[model samples]
Target: MAAKRRRPAGKGAGAIGCAPFFVLIVVALIIQYWWVLLIAVGVVALTVALVRSTSGPARPAKVPPPPRPQPVVAPPRAVPTGEDLTAQLRAHKRISRVRDMQEWDYEWIRLAHPGKSVREVNDIANTHFARGRSIGINWGDPSAP
Candidate 1:
């Protein structure tokens, strides 16, 4: 029995590559029509030269030397002093103290009574002289039933 042979990658058995054949055809074409190609190339070059020479506006060949690069002046870097940092901290601390306590007082009360509004809670809190925190704490107590 004859052994089977493995074909080389990118080609079939005994196939001639198309590249060499295409190159030969192109070379023969160029040799046969060299004068025509030369005339075409001369025409293109002449057209380009005429177009460039007679372009509408005679533009300045060397573009007016680009405006001298402006000296880049970076902003002065700021270093925060202890006083500035403390002032910022004081401002943020005051804001959080004022806002967080107010929000916390209402958030829990609202959760406990879905239908209760800010005015109702505020009125009730005022009546009992108690903020929502105490009432919410009592409601949250699992043992209170």
Candidate 2:
């Protein structure tokens, strides 16, 4: 195989060709105000130094370590079990019984008056049952457990 051609090293014409422009500026420096020449030389030197120092784009900075995780804590209370559930149900039943006992006076007065007929009470219960059934049908659910 033929030998591979080596690429040229260092800056090409684009870098070296600026010499004529620099020479012209130096010549003008001799003719013009000294302060203007000084400023121009300073700016040119700063630019050349910056370009030479940073020839490539900057790389991304390295990331620092993440903060350590904190330890987890749990509540000090115990979870309710089947016995707790049964106790809650017993409490609800006690409350319901108290309410029924208080309402018994009104039920006794109604029974003494005999205002509502058994047929009327049955009709009302049937209507309520029908309404509950319709609601259950519409929702596509089984009867409440």
Q: List the global CA lDDT of all models.
A: 0.71, 0.65
Residue-level lDDT of model 1, residues 4-42, one tens digit each, is: 998777586547657788999999999999999999999
How badly does each model clash, as a count of residue pairs?
0, 0
TM-score, predicted candidate 2 vs. hidden true structure: 0.23
* Candidate 2 residue spans exceeding 4 A from truth: 1-79, 104-145
Q: 21-128 in candidate 2: lDDT tens per residue?
A: 999998887887888878999999999999989859887899999999988888688766899979988999987864564345334434644767867655554554
Where model 1 places Cα greater than 4 Å from the true spot, the runs are 1-8, 11-16, 60-145
TM-score of each: 0.33, 0.23
Q: Which ten residues in a row have the lowest lDDT in candidate 1?
A: 128-137
RMSD of model 1 against the true structure = 15.6
